[model samples]
Target: MDATDGRLEAATVRARVATRENIARMNRSERAASALWPVPLAFGLAAILVARVTAVIDSRDALGIRGEFLIRDPDTALQLASVVASGMLVFLGIVFSTTLVAIQLAGSQYSPRAVRIFLRLRLTKVALGVFVATFVFAVAVLGEIRTKSGSDFTPTASLTVLVLLMVATVVTFLVFASGTARLLRIQYLVERIADEARPVFRDAFTRAQEVQADRPAPATATRVCTNRSPGVLDAVDVADLADAAAAAEGWIDVVAPVGGYVATGAPLAVVHGGGGGGGGDDRDGDQDVAIRRCFLLSNERTMLEDPAFGLRQLVDVAIRGLSPAVNDPTTAVQVIDRITDLLGGIADRPDPPEWYVDAAGTARVRMRGDTFDDLLRLGYVEIIRYGAGAPQVVRRLHAAFGSLSALGDARHHASIAAMGALLDAAVADAMPAPFSDLSGHPDPRGLG
Candidate 1:
């Protein structure tokens, strides 16, 4: 049965990989967005360069600069010289930008919206502004030249060419700037929405993944594991579950594997990974059995849904579950990821017409899925029940209270006390049955 169960668990776990893969695919969209800034940047630099070279040529002739000269008037020469200098600066700026972009895209950390921000500075427009201003100033100088000599300077084909170039540069600049700004605004709005709703989505993804793993597979057998020790049931702690999850590889999400007492023979911990000989070793058959049974029993026993605990232990567990492996504790990235997942599930709960309120003054108990109850039973939840009277008490409370942003604003003990009052007396009075009562004493069972 143990072997059969392990195989079944393995197969059940296989089913979830596809969903996980899908989410991963979504991540690619994010990467594509981050990669989109270089286009505008390239155009802006090219325009700046053209304007610079024209200015430098005109400057040399007017200022008596030694370099090869073309335009005769001081003003015309200076404007052309200025354009050349500006172009060189613009070229350097682009090179620097390219390097920075390469670094950021290599890791793909920034979101698409953030990339849009980088592109929306209106650099092209700014460049156009300078060109327009310079051209207007040149026209004034041309008027002065004609007034002093009482003769008009005929506009040559070269002057006409220069004017056309300037017009083209400004127009291109505005077009690029307008497009980038519009795109950036859209991306920013999307990002804000994603941020607001991220917790809920993340939790859903993780939960769905877990369900897919636990689903039954006829090819393998399954068993329940319980902590049957006579004395205190030193069952695995929440810390252990977190530790196991954290210790696993990034792609291989670890979840509680089984439920019930070690049912004579059960696997406690299960590993979800690419089965192509790339998975971690179980160490030994005994260790594998013990770990698998422990996970099953723990998840089965724990109760994770309790409104009173929505801001407390439940949130803590949710954060821990989604958190990165303990080895990567330098950042809270994983915790944030898991929090997003937890919130998503809470938000998506179907609307309930009535809130459950028991005599204990605690919210009424609304049952969640069997998996939630099974986990609660495994000692995973200190208290498990729905917030009756308000089906979405947690969500509502968070909305009113401003979420974790001001979670500390409310009195912690006060909420706990109120919760204690809400628990149904009858259920509260019931004591947990001893492990020994369920399974006969110390026979040859090796679980202990």
Candidate 2:
């Protein structure tokens, strides 16, 4: 390539593609907290530091007769510290083995998307942190053991703290084991997934209900295209983008969906009203920088703003269960219970706002949102397609539709009725006429 083209390509590669949705948030990984090592590493560092202070404290005679402390003799104390250090290595092995097994079981029993749930547990991380911390603290305490003036000296206080930490790690391991076992259950996984999605839906609904400015699209517009790599359009910082538009005396039309993936060099947004800044001015440049800063990208879509993703996961689990290899219809029934609860809340606010405005109530960005019908279809269509033959799944879906019908929002009625019609047709396709009638009954437990 020519030198000029090479320089241009180099510049493009150096350009910032996207900004983080929130710097302080931890949903930046394949799983929560990203890696398991950071927490354990932090704990290990703290253990070394604490071991020094504890050693110094135990060296003095102030802590209620150092001789009567946990262990007194230097040789015996070293042996005990050695035991703890060695034993903790075993504990670490067990933790890793158990965690891997649990993760495998969850992935095989449920959807692969559900595997992240095990990694997201706070207790599991804490257990690992405590295990590594205890091991490091014990190793540090060994250094404090020595013989002075013919008598062996022991860091009694450090030993005592190490013992307590060892106990905590044991307790944590037991609880982690139990939590992992429970996580394998389909009901728990789907319920937790649905619970996480509810607040996202409510936030989206509340934002949509709020009034926005009635600004018009400008005759002449500057289309802001992506200058770097691609990622999921996680969250659009609307208020900030609107402020950028106002600074340039322009309005923007955001040509992206919040949860969809954007391709490289795609249109990020279109700056309308000419930014009111003269050509080649700093104000126009400032608006471009602000727009770039506002589009937060993530490695994976999170529960922060993407409401449909949760339903997508739940539907994934249900449909997989209904597959011929699994053929576990009751699992889908449990998922239907969760879906019904979410749909009930969604029915209350079926339409989310497409326009976003600045503090002064001027429209600056226009982005599209899924309609009620879209979500309903997303939540039900695949399940209906795979689960039609199962009476339990069909009954539970019918029950879900009937419950959604009671919601006050008249807008949801049409979608609910349409899905009910689709469910009935799917049932007809699955079974002969007279027997298919049996699946029409709405049973909360499907059979019960």
Specify the highest-lDDT model's number. Answer: 2
lDDT of 1 by residue, 1-448 (tens): 2356355223322222111112223334433333434444554455445445544544443443423234545456446534644653564364346435633542233233233334333443344344443344334334322223544332232243455655655565556456444533423323333343344333322434222223222323222222232221112332333332223321221222211234332323334321222123432443233233322122122111122122232333322322334222211222223333343343323222111222222221111222222212221122223221111222222232233223322323243233334433312333233432322121211122
Number of colliding residue pairs in each model? 71, 0
Clashing pairs in 2: none
Error of 1 at 30 (Å): 4.5
Candidate 2 error regions (>4 Å): 1-32, 147-151, 207-209, 275-286
> After aligning candidate 1 to the native by TM-score, how far in Å is the CA of 329 from where it should be?
29
- Compared with the true structure, what per-residue lDDT tens digits does model 2 show for residues 369-391? 66777888999999899988888
Query: Model-by-model lDDT, in order?
Result: 0.32, 0.75
Question: Worst lDDT window (10 residues) for model 1?
Answer: 439-448
TM-scores for candidates 1 onward, in order: 0.27, 0.88
Return the number of clashes found in candidate 1.
Answer: 71
